[model samples]
Target: MTTSTESPCWFTSSYSDHGGQCVEVATNLPGIIPVRDSKTPGGPVLNFRAEAFAAFVAGIKAP
Candidate 1:
């Protein structure tokens, strides 16, 4: 994947624990939501559509 000239502002979930099992997400880019392992900042990133990612999060919160 080609690197974007714009840098993403990554942030870990507020509920993240000290176990280092959390992931980071960057919403600075338009249309895409980038996710990466918090333990590996320089590692590969996974990109998902903004709407799709929102739906996924909602699904996770659903009972």
Candidate 2:
């Protein structure tokens, strides 16, 4: 969970163009990566390990 003193710098991918269906991710935090829906900024966030998140992104980019 993110502490009150911390705020994630969320950003959406430039490839996102699915009629408002998109996700935002914040990798500024140490060890953890926070993710949330772009459509709902105030909604609940899902946390992932930094390494795991990196792997996921890499996989998506891989052909």
lDDT of each: 0.88, 0.85
Clashing pairs in 1: none
lDDT of 1 by residue, 1-63 (tens): 233539998888888775789899988788899999989999999999989999999999999
lDDT of 2: 0.85
For model 2, how does the per-residue alpha-carbon lDDT over 1-63 read when each residue is reduced to its tens digit?
Answer: 343337898888888875679999886788899899889999999999989998998999899
TM-score of each: 0.86, 0.82
Candidate 2 residue runs with Cα over 4 Å from true position: 1-5
- Candidates in order: C-alpha RMSD to true structure: 4.7, 4.0
At residue 4, give the lDDT of candidate 1.
54
TM-score of 2: 0.82
Model 1 stretches with alpha carbons more than 4 Å out: 1-5
